[model samples]
Target: MEKEHRAYKSHCLVLPYPSQGHINPLFQFSKLLDHKQIKVTLVTTRFTSKTMHRGSSGIELEAISDGYDEGGIDQAESIQAYIESFWKVGPETLAELLEKLSSSGCPVNCIVYDSVMPWALDVAKKFGIVGAAFFTQSCVVDSIYYHVNKGLLNLPLTDSEISLPGMPPLEPLDLPSFVYDFGSYPAFFEVVIGQFSTVDKADWVFCNTFYELEEQVVDWMAKFWPLRTIGPTIPSKYLDNQLDDDKDYGVDLFRSNNDACMKWLNEHPKNSVAYISFGSFAQLGLEEMEELAWGLRRSKSKFLWVVRESETAKVPKGFIEETAEKGLVVSWCCQLEVLAHEAVGCFITHCGWNSTLESLCLGVPLVAMPQWTDQSTNAKYIRDVWKIGVKAQPDEKGIVRREEVEHCISEIMEGERGKEIQKNAMKWKDLARKAVIQGGSSDKNIDEFIATLVKR
Candidate 1:
């Protein structure tokens, strides 16, 4: 008797929690799966799905697929509150997609879940699909995330010093944005953590950082969760496709540039350029913005500043004219490429997760200027954990001063401390490369993951 036939290729759905930081990594992991010849079903909120799949450069998640719906924040306490509450609809939305694909004779093999969302595991179990968790932060941060809810945040002592396993204990002032400030307005930390029900229950967990980048912390998390570190994913992929002959990747359609910035960098010496960006989500108050401008002007360092159109950015009038000759302000530039450029010596950043990882992988030290959300968490790691960056303080209105900014930049670039961070950053870079090589922990884990994902 003849047996029924199986599908042509294995397919896995990759879903990020729907933010630029989440979207970028999920796209990388999905592409990595495709590279291994597995078919992909990339999932996103309706809006992000449109943004991510808008290119011929990679696999696009089709809206025509069944169960596809417009993704929006739920009508909960707040959008941040909605992140956790949205899980109630996860099973339903996922079911629609599954039923649609099955009806079309294509059954999903497994799921690659974002570690932040635990509900993915439940949906995976319902369909007998393998649930894989893709962790977006470094393992150092991961260990903290896994434990912060377990009596850490509930510590009764005010301004208590907390010690992470690998580094020295930290004061409340040192704890970046996500942990302490979450009690304040519009905090996602409270909601997201409460709803982190799916990720810890997964069959396999994948991390975006390579093993060596967070070796000690990665090793520690392995006992609690089935962990795999597979990052420097963005830079790793970028290096693969860049051509020696091409001037730019031509992915510039997404970027808006103001080129006077590049011209300023051209005039500066190699490794002398200070590139300033507060990252995708970090914001500055009006006072902080002007102070930073004046600080950059006073530092005597040739600089490139990225002016993102965020709600918090308040640019003063006459500012452009005052600093135009020495400083270049641009909407955006090819960030990874710019960091990798020899002209970039120091980075002034808000320490978003991606920016921290990217700058670290490129061996560039940072002058951390974290604003809110996970920016503080990332800043803590960059400043306290990694010893590769310096932190800038926020004022009474929660804005840091211009003189302090100038002093901080000078301290990082020309003083004895700046030299130290540069040294440490290069050390991290060497290990990052080592981790991506064959037989390395990250390399082995990625190979094993793709094998299981495609074969099972």
Candidate 2:
């Protein structure tokens, strides 16, 4: 670490994918650094960042953007155009920002990037400071994809019937059609294949998970990369449990409709309401949406769903009204608060890593419906390894089945086995809390990871 006499103020830029799940971790990560007394600039597309506050109070944000704020693109066409433009124009924006910062007295010395945004590695190289790419998924799952793409899989299976030995086989019935088919994740797979190369370009690869959640996978990643796992970095947990009455320390880094969601969750019983959401970006078809809607209705349990405007993927209308009184479906919900609510019993999620960790931290069980990408791997951990949830099935092309959805929902919420999973959920939840508590594993890991970035 840099000594005070020769040391300079540490400057870092946090770049996240313009999606909700991607932004949540990025925000939490920046907060964790701030807690450690490091200077950070958290950047997001101006459009997405607007959601941070419904009505502005004029409070300063980490840092603002300039020259083509990424907020204008909406819908598939706009998104595609923006991405193409991003690929062609993104790096220069980063470089220009760094140049501006350096011109000011406080020059940026390092960058912490979302692993998917390899452009960050280039930014770090440009400034000649260490960069760490945050991998938001379990390393184990990423390794499987990396190995599979590199011809590591000689499985008799040809299609997406992905079954790792000793791990549960998550058929298309349980995963998104794209992942079951493998070819569907063209962009994600390309990113996965290119992930290792980024490690060489980075100072290290950081994950928002701990050793307990993924012992083997982290070990594997560490062999080839300077992998650092430190997390469950929610700010609320740092405060005393009795401080629920306290005001939020700062704005939520991501935009989620908190007021309505919190009221709905507050009404449910301790360990009773089933929390459901498919983090952002996994588009769902009508049949799939209906299957989920019907299955949740059949489960005869209360639920809070975070469904974005694009959620239905053009599904029918009556479903939401059909269960309006018994269900709460919002465009977005404050996930950490919902999970922490004593009323939330189990989580019906797409098994995105961020969602997975939140459920684990709350110690709630899962109804795993991994839409695409590493979701299958995350689902495996929830069902097979963690033993905290059941995997819902998907159809031939990778949509979830109603029966599978119904069965898993019933099993997780009311079945005899559900009771057992809930019990384990509580146990794991405690461990998660311990991991983040002072002197805990996560705490130590963060210290170590920061040590790597600390200038000497």
Candidate 3:
């Protein structure tokens, strides 16, 4: 190793897809690297960078444009237009940013990028820095994508059940929404399918999941590439059972109402509250929103919901007022704190991977209401493979009715089924914690990965 490299001060430029789900894990991973005494810089799109709360002391933050930074690709006409605009501008912009960073004394030794942006690997290779693909989603989902790209699995799936080696059988509904309806989201479908083509070109690959949690898929992927399990990329405070001081990831795309939500949770009886959220991006139809409202009220469970302020218009006019005593609705809250709270018995979620892992790590059972993308696969794992949650099935019209929602809520929060799921959830929580502490599976993987990075 050269003198600078011999010092083990590897500087890594981390780039995450600009979405809230993608940014959080990469940012947390950056913090972990900084904690390990590596120089870290997290890069995001200009718009996402603006929304982040700058609190982490050791990490550097930077931004590159995705062309439509003012409001992001939401302003574009379609998914195709949005992504095309991103490709037209993102790669060149990122290349310039890396060059500037290198010339200004912080030469990057490696590039760790979210797999969604496969084009980043090319840019990193051009710069002669090692490229590592970081998956913000589950290893199972990534493996599924790999199969799809390899033409081993067909899309708009014809079978009621799709089987993959080492994973539970999946129904069409269990696959990502994009798989069934590619026409409506051609750009997103393309990006997801194309990610694997360049994934093998990278020096290393990381998943925000622990080996114990998805051992089958993690092992399956390692046979194909230099894949490593180095996560539950949540804060060490939650996963490692460290002190509460390390809780916040220090970046919030949405403003949080932490104090009010925490206070509401505190007043509930132990393990009595049903915490509901659909993550940052999923939007519900007005009919579906009204159904969920009535369902929560009918279940008569103490509930805390995080609905975006913009979506509140969909709720029945008198719904919030009628359930005032039983339910608290906020625009957003610190999800980790709420999930960690003693009163939270069940999480009614859209089954996003981050939410899935968080619920598992904190021992909160789930009411899976998967919406789109990888959420469906995540919901499948929660309800079937893990058995720590119940999947809320929708009707023929694709609406999860109020009665169905109520039934699921009751079963997961009050029935014998709830007790079983809760026990399983707690078991997984202990395993997740074990995988993150010193000498644990995830910790050891991260330690070895860092050692490898320094040597490179």
Candidate 4:
């Protein structure tokens, strides 16, 4: 009877930051826990929950009001104000939800919260539940933030080139876009820095990356907190080729028009299409957008581009009609499915960690143009550490011109550099597969995490 009662304690609440990038990996983690027979409840904002495609799955979907459920932080006065509101309102609602769960007799045993939402840790502690911080970004970025919290690396860094305890030397250009001078966007830096401060409160620190990918950063991070690698938290179909009943993550915020994209790719020759997407959030100026459109047109390579409906207005007149035969543009896509296509020769990306991992895992080289946040850092790893991509340098106005874009597209498709990058991508692909299989690094780490949770 005691054992039977203890078995019911395997319920976990997953709280991801309400964004497409943050939500996807945590959703994958929830599915993984469910595979281990742990009951999972994924919490989302009212607006985000409505947008997500929560099909039949073992994980229960729960919604919490984040004040601006309709417009989200976009409706807030400022970024600082939005964050303040999120922290203020989110904890209260989450606490109430926990109480409701307890009263219903489905008490949560563990609360796995996105590291970005550090305040959630406090909510979990208040409810006397085990708290774990899940970092959805690269381990190197986490390590950089950890150093920044320690005051070892002063921001608005005095020296242009800065070296940290475990990471490669970084230039101001290489740091996450949020880490500007003290006078500029201080609140953004504060919020990012604050994430590390709450780490000691968490029972475990989970990274959505494998050991071989960022070994030094992971080792350095473990010294501070109990850490584990249970990623790349991608769908099983893509990673291990597991043909489970529920293979897709089924959490697309936008409708995935994959059928058209995949059919278009089928028409192209193998390794022929240059796939372009700047992630879901990053915005481009009209001038830059036009430049990219012209560049893709001039490059003459067959391509697929994912741009927002709003941003599509910025394209130069007749650009799409001119390239209709050679190009395909869509508002949103099932990115994993697109990247895994055999015709995708290279990726032109914003260097978001998800895009980075997917490209590398599928053995597709990159043409990196980092926009903001951890993107520049991820680009640094791609161009410098991983050697599986090339960075597109912006011009005097910080815009990647048509010439540069055309050059990068051509460079990655043809030449010796492209060959070397392809080789590296294939190598990383093999390593990524090894990390997810039975008895592999990620699998063992996940098992250890479950054992610890059960023991607690």
lDDT (Cα, tens digit) per residue for candidate 3, span 1-456: 132343336889899888778888888888778777678888888877776676644467888988878887777787788788887788899899888888856589888998988888999999998899998888888888888899899876788888987788787777787876655577788998888878879999999999999998888889989888888888877878542357877787788879999888888888888999999999999888988888898886899998998888887898888899999999999899999999998999999999999999999999999998999899888988899999888989888999998899899878999999989999999999998889989889878878988887
| Candidate 4 residue-wise lDDT, 137-167, digit = tens | 8888888787788887776678878887678
Looking at candidate 2, the ten consecutive residues that score lowest on lDDT are: 54-63
What TM-score, to 2 decimals, does candidate 4 have? 0.95
Provide the overall lDDT of each model, using Cα atoms, as 2-decimal numbers: 0.69, 0.68, 0.86, 0.86
RMSD of 4: 2.7
Separate clash counts for every candidate: 9, 8, 0, 0
After superposing candidate 1 on the true structure, give the runs of residues whose Cα lies further than 4 Å from its correct spot: 1-9, 51-53, 63-77, 80-85, 103-106, 152-159, 185-187, 237-254, 258-264, 311-313, 395-397
Q: Write the per-residue lDDT of candidate 2 for residues 322-414, one digit (tens) a residue.
A: 888888888876677777788887788878887788787777789987766777767867887788998877778767766777687778778
- Per-prediction TM-score, please? 0.86, 0.83, 0.95, 0.95
User: Which wins on lDDT, candidate 1 or candidate 4?
Assistant: 4
Tell me the tens digit of each residue's lDDT in model 1 across 118-204.
777787888888888887776666666556666655533365787777656776655645666545644566544543455656888
Clashing pairs in 2: 1-456, 2-455, 2-456, 173-393, 173-394, 174-393, 174-394, 177-398
lDDT of 3: 0.86
Q: Which stretches of model 4 miss by more than 4 angstroms?
A: 1-9, 180-184
Which is superior by lDDT, 2 or 4?
Answer: 4
**Candidate 3 TM-score versus the reference:** 0.95
